[model samples]
Target: MPTSNWNIMVKASQNPPFAAENYSIAEIKNEVLLQIRSGKDFPVTSAAISLIGQLTSEQEVPVAELANVVLGDYGLTSKLLKLINSVYYLRFGEVTTVSRAIVLLGTDHLRDVALSFTLFERLQTDASDHIINLLCRAVYAAVVGRRIASQTGYTNPEEAFICSLFHTLGEMLTAYYAPGTYAALSKGITGSGAEESARVRTSLLYLSLGKEIAQSWRFPARIVCCMEKPTVKMSEHDDVYRLSCIASGANEVAHIVEESLDPEDRQRKLEKTLKNVHLSASLISGNGDLTAPVEDVHKYCSLYGITFERSAIARSLNQRREENEQAQGPLKRPTNNTAEDAPFDLPPNFNGSSSSPFSSLPEAQDDSETVFTNGLREVGDAFLEECPLDDLLTIILETMYRGLKPFGLRRTLLLIRDARRPAMEVRLSLGDPLASIKSWFSIPITAIGSDVFNIALSEQKHLFVNDSTVPPIDGQPLIPSWLVEHIDRPVAMGVLPLHIKRVSIGMIYLEGEKNFFTTVPQNYLNYVKILHQQAAIAIRQR
Candidate 1:
């Protein structure tokens, strides 16, 4: 599915009227879940439901089995791996595989990652700007919750993350599954007299519906508890109550940040909200720096592929940062040199762009190289940290997939030798139409015969064919006939072999469009080789 804003209003006219006042909460909850389950995105919903069940089951789920469940979905696997490797979770080093991530970060963290992605996936459909804004607020709340958990030394910060993320589940789902009713309730609850009753009823409806979904999804008892507005005063000794406070407070802060334009008004509202929850501003920002939480929100947005600039909360936060910076004025640098002593002369014959040769390249290509360079650094870090073999290989493959994207990299396949059979099969792939081509990419290995792919594996050499249709001097085509018959003949291709203790394991197959490998820099090719060598080292270590 395409990653875009979710369009809840697309089927709004077709939706039945969801009058919360008429039916019992149970009836309404069941109806909503049924509607969601029967909708067009049921397959995605079902998969998420199944994964949640496995993660939260009473019986112990084996590490390998759990990892398999996660890896079964391409998007989930990609996002989960990325989340685990993010700065927030990167404690030991780079985590590559779901199994190793489970071992290192624990199952609770993995469960939260899965939940976060599921929520993100649901809200990411093509939608109105308002709905997208709501989604951004939820993400902001979750990020704040995680930070609060960390600052307060909470044992399970992931729990805090999930609690805060789903804090507005009731409101968000109502908006998504029943936009008309949401709009009606939203409008009706904004005044005195009968409006106050409407407000109370609306709150109850949202809260009850959210609770029902949580219960149906088998969310932990504590999470469900945290979803509700805390009615009682928080006790210092009650950790769960404190956690609930954090979740609720973070959610309120998210709303305040988005809804309030004036910094003073926002800060005052934030302070009041935190005070009501028995939390201090310092708990969120250790030094009472209000802008800290806002910066963290932007950082998390970047980490999760969210368009930070488009978020209303982000704009509000930016304003707050600007105001705060202006209030404090610019900082003075501690310089030992006088104004005349400081060197300010430009080098001889130096143009602004003379410092880097890449200045002449397109911005996208430069960004691509930067991504590849970062990927190489990550792989090197993983090696130093002795990251699990499977995880390291995944990182390497994902890096190559993302880095080569600018070169018209359409599909990347990792064909590994099956231990039990003399055949190379597609172990992993990245890019579109994978289901169509993944199954057809098996190559039989034989001592007597030679194909370009087999030859690269056997000889442990890299091959770059700019155009597969052109016959080499040997009059042999680089791409096998079977491949051409099953899939579109790629205009350009790259084959980098992987080895373990001098024995061939697999090769990374990169397929692209016209002139794919022609203009790529030598340094980029060297980076690719380094990534392959890192994979080899990982294999040998295994």
Candidate 2:
């Protein structure tokens, strides 16, 4: 039996006054929160059990009425179902629906289920990693609590579930409302304590809040007292005390498993906890092939006629122990997102070289023939196979340099649109390093001297600058000086459209004096045209 140090009425009095003898439904709910933190899982569990009676009685709850309640809190219903489906439930695989969950889990479990629904719903929105971690830890602890209930043959599995689930409700609210402060405290404790650090003190603050809420709600005295003094003695035969012990041990295990504690000390604590529970040390060690899978554990327990209740208590503890053991090893941190994490950048020339008759002339007649065709096919194929998006752009620009070197084209620039920033940023370049080229690489789509920029911005691939003498499109010189100085030689330029799926991607700028194209071999010019199309497709896909 559970004992109490605080009166339910006294605790309820701390909140708005309410009649305890003939308590209303809201008052009963208020008390439910109190009982949870008080370490008395039974009263709340009992109330949930009582609800089962009401639900199944001759006056069955109207299906529409139940639907409205469930829809009002869809997340709660979902979580309840998930919990029911978890390894915690005895019927494990068969039951699924909320209605079924209520029937199988009982009224006592339902109340606790409702509490868990509210608890996590609140925690998900919290910003503090510390509190979030604590929330996770608390859930693990709740797992322990439910396991204990199972072992002790607690009739209401949902009550045990709720008790474990909301035992750390204070932590949930703290993480939700004051994450920064919680984070600071967590940092301070971890930095100082290594494995020796104990969060029990920090957690007590939230425990107090749980206690306060329980008292305000007018929960049973058995639970109210436990909330007021968590250290209170439990009878050797007290099932609730056993449940609380399992939860307490589980929380400590979570920290150890996450390696948030000192290695040697964490090991010692875990070993002692396991010994006290008569569990196998190898189960938590996570050594070579020694760990038990949940299914195996279930099988083992069933062989002994052990209910899921006891199995849950045992399994969660051991799992956390294994997690802690793993955490004891050196930590591996994730680095910044690299090119490998991104998709490939599609080039404008995905269709390959056109087979048009105009592109087969000899090199001596067409100077631009070798510009983009030289090694263009080989490099483009290699880039598609090997390069990541960031480096792909660089490789594409380099490929352009390799292919166009014989043409005396001297400079090439690639600009790509930034989705997040929604602007054009310079991607690749072939020019003097001192020309502020970096800034030119990623110019805003709305501003720039590049024909590619104009093409992408206007969704037009047919832009052309037949005459530099024409007025600048936006009061700026049509031919940028960067282009003039970087080219190493003056030349007229032709901007031809690059398209993919009828959408404008970018433009290929062919530079040379007028009639230069008449001199360059058509085969090489065809290569440049093909490269442009591939480049357009590549960049767009990225």
Candidate 3:
């Protein structure tokens, strides 16, 4: 359901003389926009729409700019990082920075990912079954389209994904903005023209509305073109036309998969659709595995947090896979007796043993160690990729924050020397979100002081205070009075100075509760120092 005004307007359009035919396309488009704006969540929706437009625009957006946009949205940043680190993209190793992700995944793929997330967030607020089904189909189509593009050797599979995902944008928006009209259109009305004409008009209404919105959102020309249904006979050589065919064919395949038809019927319909689009049957059954794409769909659904089990398409696809597997029977192993062809098996002495030999081995590394190891590897990869300075610094800081969590890491801040000022200021922070505390991170470089922070930076050394409240034998406090007044005496703290060619530039400030530093293992502390070294290296390289 939509706003009352839009519902009334759509319901009124079904009457004689005031029907949809009487209204110009422009009028309908304006009404749609107005109704969308009139909704209660328009402000949030408008911002998301604007972000999608920026992400998907045709112009070349700088990596830093794109990374900045993504970093501004905490949820999107977290999800995007999670997706990049998922098994799907794990071949690229761990990506800790948005800029690195954009570089590895390409702007097109990340743009589509961002767009899908934005649309899902905006439309799923009051989503009904219809909306959920549409969203699933959209994602399913994108996955299928990417497969088709890869099979056909298209230059950009991600572009194909975007085209296919947005193909149903108009229908989805219609269902959200004017469910009554969408329902009425779903059940066709008796018209004077041929059934095909009526069908064409109905399809055009949705496509045209989608095109209008695409234009408003500044989506690329190829995406808008793919939104339209392909002509009866399209040129296979034209890239845009080929993408359009792929999108249309993929969407049709999605519909066929969801149908109540038997496996044979569904296969026949799928083949027919692919043939009409000039695609090979191999796309459907690559290497005789018909369920690969279905499995991929499920993986993507998990990444997007969509409940694939609830989808009719998922059920149908699973049923098809089961039937295919049943027909193939149980797999038989090779009977060859050659030593090289022998199957892997456990030792005879261990097979029937009650106790396991591995029981005496040391346990696996803890989560914090894994985090530190992964962070180190990610930093190494970033260096190999020649990651931009800002992004590399972000990775270093984030690594330290996450890896030190087991040691009660409360907040970590990167304070860099201001180029035009006599003081260092907080450039990046993690694990804390208090603006007041963040602002207090500034340290005047020229101020004569021997406190822990100043000492670390001036001497280019690392300082770890196990208990800030205990004064040294000199009867002078190590913790500065200003820090005590503002932060109310942090129980523990660590400072690692950043230097370029032996000249101090800044310091990393870590604050936590009691036993933060006392509890940290020597190896973990070494890992933190390694991360600090990487930050210094990044700064030197820059």
User: What total of clashing residue pairs does each candidate reach?
Assistant: 9, 53, 0
TM-score of 1: 0.60
Please, what is the TM-score per model? Answer: 0.60, 0.38, 0.67
Displacement of residue 85 (Cα, Å) in model 2 is 4.9
- What is each predicted model's overall lDDT from 0 to 1? 0.65, 0.44, 0.68
lDDT of 3 by residue, 1-542 (tens): 22333334444644232344345445555566555566676566557656656654647654544654665566677678777776557688756555567778877777777877776666665457677777778878887787778778898887887798889888888778766566665554233422554455557778888887767766667888999767766666789889999899888877776766875676688788888877787665532222233445655655555665566675665555455458885434455643222222112222222332222322212367876787788788888888767667766776676667667877778888899988878777666442444566677775554678777777778988878776743665677776777665447989898988887788889988876888888998999998998888888878
Query: By TM-score, who's the top model here?
Result: 3
The parts of candidate 3 lying over 4 Å away from their true place are 1-26, 52-78, 94-103, 124-127, 189-194, 215-221, 231-238, 261-272, 275-292, 318-373, 384-390, 400-496, 506-530
> What would the per-residue lDDT of candidate 2 be over residues 454-537, giving only the tens digit for each residue?
544465543434343445555565565545455444454555544556644444444554344455456755666566666676
The alpha-carbon deviation from the true structure for residue 524 of candidate 2, after best TM-score superposition, in angstroms, is: 69
| Model 1 C-alpha lDDT versus the unseen true structure | 0.65
Q: What value does the lDDT take at residue 185 in candidate 3?
A: 58
User: Could you tell me the lDDT of residue 8 within candidate 3?
Assistant: 45
Candidate 2: global Cα-lDDT? Answer: 0.44
Candidate 2, residue 443: how far the Cα is off, in Å? 74
* Residue 389 miss distance in model 2 (angstroms): 64
Looking at model 3, the pairs that clash are none
Q: What lDDT tens digits, residue by residue, belong to model 1 across residues 408-503?
A: 777777778999999888766656333445567788887843667778877878988888776654766567788778555547888888887778
Model 1: residues with Cα > 4 Å off, grouped in runs? 1-144, 147-153, 176-180, 187-200, 211-226, 229-366, 432-438, 468-478, 500-502
